[model samples]
Target: MSSPSTQPFAMGGREFVAMMASLQALQALAIDAMLPALGVMSHDLGVDGSNERQLIIGIFLIASGLGSLFPGALADRFGRRPVLFVCVGGYVLFSLAAALAPTFGALLAMRACAGVLSSGMIVVSSATIRDRFSGDKMARTQSLVSVVFMIVPMAAPTLGLAVLELFGNWRWVFGIMAGLGAAVFVWAWLRLPETLHPEFRQKIDVRAIAGNMRIAFTTRSAIGYVFALALIQGALFGYINSSQQLVAEHFGAGDLFPLVFGAMAIAMAMANLTNSRIVMRFGARRVSHAAVIAYIILGATQLFFASGEDETIWQFIPIMTLNLCVMGFISANFSAIALQPFARIAGAAASLQVFLRMVIGSVLGALIGQAYDGSARPLAVALVAAGVGCLLLVMFSERGKLFRRLHGQVEQA
Candidate 1:
């Protein structure tokens, strides 16, 4: 295979980032938009356990992870555009099917299928960005994408609530998702170009695919950062899985849920936007390392103060916002660092990276979420553990070193 080109598409930088952000935001929209509807859907679907209601979110995440494992190879083999179109189509179809599902089991099955298809967007968007840039530039670009992508999470629950209010049914939430998917599909179809260069395209060979997988998994930084990303994401997923319950049940602020969630998301978006501007100067490692340390400190503080039923919304909001803001710094940088060595097999590398992050994070997060006891203690404790674990992983990835810029310095590990 030929070396990957740094400028494979003709689009301007801003437009490209917007397009990629929109594609990536699909996953966020799918998950977050359904949050406000979870209660109503649970009652309608006759779900028995309070914890099982979260399966509506957890199932999609797990399915997305399972579905994500193959899209990179498929994108590398067939090309990004075609695979993306097919995936979006499946996402649309299954979303509609989910709305029409007659039983809870059937709805879960459709959601899982939708998640599988949704992996195409996540893998292909990252691979597309990888095809165009590398190093800190890639990190900066991803931060920019995240700035735009965060808009969905900020608005999705509110949007879901609005849709529910307008239609007076939870099923319409899925309909809205289908509508959004269709719109994005049409936009991508009309404007997006294939980013994979012909010389870089790989044949569907098991031996070659295995070799690339080995390269991605064995690289010390790649694997370490992958797990770090997963751990950090686990904390975020735990929050998402329990955000509705935490705010409504614990704080007695059911109506204020969207405002609280949106505020946190806005903080994250602002952090990513700031990161996009400063990442090139400070480097991905330095920024991400500082962020992780901050995350740990914030998590520890929140855990200490938020114990038992005494925690208040005012106490929870600021700490969670700051922690998630730090997450904005960590997520893009860690992903870029992990993908730095795999230009030749970016699709596969991104697939595996996302697969591990989503599967491990979603599962661990779901477990933490299920352990919720009408208090923020479980979430805080889980986040503290996740932050510490992420810091250790970063240390291992850098061979006991931290905060060194990767732009000019030789990697010690």
Candidate 2:
């Protein structure tokens, strides 16, 4: 089957990549950018709790995952642009609702709603790429998206910190999310054309839905890789939940915690830039397998350091930063691999894949947060468990295959 583009519109690979990257940017802008404000929100609402701090992160993801299922079913039925427009609109409304929430519970509920809407943005954005690209090109494009993802994250913490310092409150972060949501909605509404063709639309008949789901689940490589990628992402989320506590509380990172986070962000960005160049040449599997191996090695070292030592900031930074850098390659490449087998079912596949990625990752993030004991032990343990498991699964699923195996595969229909 041919990929999405026929004539290759004015915004082909580069524009598509940049635009898709905005979806990730919007997410980071929503969650991470709101973090510094969580304390203020809790204090303002008289919430007076510790978990409220992480609620800013967790609630958004929970809602996003729940919101993903329908858009997949709808996107191919109606067309991508419509779904994109609605999702972005949903994000804007919910972000504003969150900003205006009168009580802590109201704000939390709105945050959850925002996540639900945001998931549509995430799912459709990936589907847009599947419409236009496939195989190693798809992986490379995703790598560029990963780079944009990291760049936004690198700035988000510092930005949030600055806004909190100047404004002395958290609602401004939500205000920013509202503004961004509005701008992106306008940009996408104007620039993105309808990519799904009428002939390709799947009616929402039971038989059609069942047939699509069966096709998605029956694809061995795609299913295996999606679960594997989700497991890896769960590990990443664990780090996200624990990183600040680990750095600030355990390592005495103080206000410099953002700097530490920024350093790791830089490492992840470098890996993405490297993947963008080589993923096309080597294919995603060759790149991913190597990166997973590196991830396992790095994770094991971190686990060892935490096992016995009064570990200093110097010790943790090197190993944890290395692990995250390797993950940039693993995250996008594994996703590209997982989605490579179904063209007709690309939206369904991305939806399911993203759902599990969120569900599993959020759970792991919660688990790590629960295990928090004023130490880095929980983060290190979760990473080692999740990272090594991902490597083993990749080995088993592919039967020692890498990019060489893709010579005969679809990468996605």
Candidate 3:
């Protein structure tokens, strides 16, 4: 494979960001596109209870976390492009299989497998970004990628509804996912260059991989930020897992579910766009730290006001939008901070970071989702707890220091 710097990029910045965003957005597409179909899936699959429908979403995340553990190492050993191709291929195959599933268990299994494969796309795309940029620039680039990525969530639910309406079945949704994956796969094959530097490539050895993993874990800031990111992601996932039920059942807004979810996604996207511009001046720590504190306050207020009464759609939507707006500031910055300490092990580090984030978030979010008791109280309480956890983790990561930006600390890949 050619060295990243020696080879001319097949695509420019706009196309690069778009391609990377699409790869990352695939996971969102898979999850969000199924939101409108959950009720149908529950009935068709014989899933009992309202809460169990969340498993269709939560299970994919859990499986993605587990499946993410190995992709980083593979990407490090082989190369980003090749590993990505394999992931996209597996994703396409499993997505197609999911469409043909005859039982609920079969569908869940297929979705889980597809999620595992999709984890590679997440890991490799992140590692690729790390290979090309670092520090505030990395955060900025990621925020830009997120700006594009959020489009998927904003449109996914409506797209799912449209597909269901057109095809008259939920199975066609998975077929759409498969087709989109195939298109991305071909685009990537033709345009995406290998970003891993030849010098940084490591052999696929158990001891070496273990040593690298130890390095990532032992690094104070990396692991601390990883866990913090996980907690915040847990809160986000909790919202996602319970959103359909919250809107459809609680508010009786079945047809309006997509608009509500899309509004929140738009809020997040706007925040990301703003972060991409301001992060360079304020620094990742300052921006994300402030956002987390605000998130805590909002969560607390949401829990306080939302207790003992049903929150009207107006009240709930604005509060949730503000809460998610805070997340837009947190996610990209935390990810960049967590990956700041490693270069040669970018792939491995990205994998471990994503694995921790996905698993912890999946489990914590699943708990909150399963605790759904016909109200948004559970979600509010869970968000506050997650915010507290994030604050603690961030404090530990910074060695009790807050908001102090280190000059000349940016890592160059």
Candidate 4:
């Protein structure tokens, strides 16, 4: 593997961002595209409970979280491209297994395995970004990557629905995932270069791995934002797990569920786009701090509306869109901030942080999802509570400080 300094990226900035975004998008597609098929999938697979279908999404995410622990270490030992190929290949195989599963349990098992594989893609992508950039510049690049990343969430359900309409089967979703995985594998094999510095490579030793993981977790400057990211992820995942139910059943959007959900994604994507432009000026901390506070306020307003038994989609969409818009600002900034401290062990640090956030987020999301009672109240409560939890964690991390800029170019606003 050649160092980035010796061998420049074969691709330009736009293609690089696009490839990274596509790697992350595979994970989003695995979840979002399945949302529309949860009902039919449950019925076909003989699942008896409505809430149980939520596991189709929740299990994959939880498993992905657990899987995050290994990829960065492996990428550090090996190289980014090889680890990516392995992940993509495994994802394709598991996706095919899922498409052919005879029962829901088997399908879920396949999903879990596939989730584990896809985590490598996500962690490696982040580590690759970390290898090349840091601080506010990294945040801006991540925001740009996220802008493309948001496209999958915005369109996956609609694409899933189209597949169902065209093919009359839900399993085709997995087939599509497999096809896309293969495509990414080919793309990466052809163009993606190893970004890990040779000097930073560690031998695959248990103690070293443990030590690296510990450093990532114990870093005073980074760990708070890591936990804060987890709290915020809980809210985000809760919405994802419950969104179809909330839109299609609770609010009775029915077939229009995809459109409604896509609209919320658009709100988030726009926020990311705006953040990319302005992040270098205000600094990630200042922008994200303000956004998270706004997130709490929006959550409170959403709760107020959802609390009423008579809450309408009209009451829900606007507040919820605003809530997600703020979320768009929170995630990329938090990730960039949390990752700012690590340079030498970027892969392992990224791995540990991703693991923490994914695990915490998945568990909390599953709990919030299961609390569904034919209304948005449970999700609303979870969102507000997550926002407050994140705020306190951020405060603790910053020693009660907020909006302090670490970058000299970006002044304290």
lDDT of each: 0.89, 0.77, 0.90, 0.90
Deviation in angstroms for 193 in model 3? 0.8
Task: Write down the TM-score of every candidate.
Answer: 0.96, 0.95, 0.97, 0.97
Model 1 per-residue lDDT tens digits across residues 240-355 = 99988988777887877987888889999999999999999999999999999999999999998887457778888898899999999999999999988887688988898899
TM-score, structure 3 vs. true: 0.97
The TM-score of predicted model 2 comes to 0.95
**Which sections of candidate 4 miss by over 4 Å?**
1-6, 408-413
Residue 317 displacement (Å), model 2 = 1.6
lDDT by residue (1-413, candidate 2, tens digit) is 34554334676666667778887688777866765455567788887666546776787776777777778878878778788888888888888888788988898899888888888888888877777777887788888988877877787878888978888776677777888879878877777777665556788777886677677767777767777777777777766766666776678987887777887898999999999998878878888888878887888788788877587888889988888888888988888777777677777777887887888778777777767777677778877788777877776668766555376664433
Residues 1-413, model 4: lDDT tens digits: 11262256778889989999999999999999999999999999999697999999999999999999999998889978888889999999999999999999999999999999999999999999988888888899899999999999999999999999999999899999999989988998898877888887877999988988888888777888889889888888888898888889988999999998998898899999999999999999999999999999999998998888799999999998998889989999999888877777778988999999999999999999999988989988988898999999899888999999974332110
Candidate 3, residue 381: lDDT: 95
Worst 10 residues of 3 by lDDT: 1-10
- The clash count of every prediction, one per candidate, is 0, 10, 0, 0
Clashing pairs in 2: 37-170, 63-116, 64-115, 340-411, 340-412, 341-411, 341-412, 342-412, 342-413, 343-413
